[model samples]
Target: MPAKRWNELSPRTRKLVVVGATVDAVLRIAALVDLARRPAAEVRGSKRRWVLAVTLLNSVGVVPIAYFLRGRRPQPA
Candidate 1:
């Protein structure tokens, strides 16, 4: 879905989607980080690189949504 669609959603819905995406992004980022720690000999080939690239992209994609959702939270009185 487009980022514009996120803006159209209700704050509650946007928060849920952003939080979910953030968690997903973190998990994928962790996996990518772990892959780097492994020895090159143990790591696979193009498959590993592809996974890392995709994860990086997703991690980047989650940032704006998360930021926008954070701003949507009601301030405590």
Candidate 2:
């Protein structure tokens, strides 16, 4: 969006946008850090592919959450 349009938004709207963006950035950073730390053998799918997806896909933490939940192997009992 244009800078003028952004400035025209109410303070509440600006605050919400900033908060949401900060949360998303934190999620992305955390996901990347986890991916780097996780053992390759523990990841269920292709590790490289998942890393690319979580890094490239900018969908408000959805893809990162999916990786943490579904793309990793279950721990041994």
Off by over 4 Å in 2: 1-4
Each candidate: RMSD: 14.5, 2.3
Task: Name the candidate that leads on TM-score.
Answer: 2
Tell how far residue 25 is off in model 1, in angstroms. Answer: 1.4
* Native-to-model Cα distance after best TM-score fit, residue 41 in candidate 2, in Å: 1.2
Q: Candidate 1 residues 1-77, lDDT tens each?
A: 54666568899998888898777767566555655554554434443664545455655545334333331234347
Q: What's the lDDT for all of these models?
A: 0.54, 0.83
- Give the clashing pairs for model 1: none
- For residues 1-77, write the lDDT of model 2, one tens digit per residue: 54658868899999999998888888778878887888988888777898898888878889888887887788678
Number of clashes found in candidate 1 = 0
- How big is the RMSD of model 1? 14.5
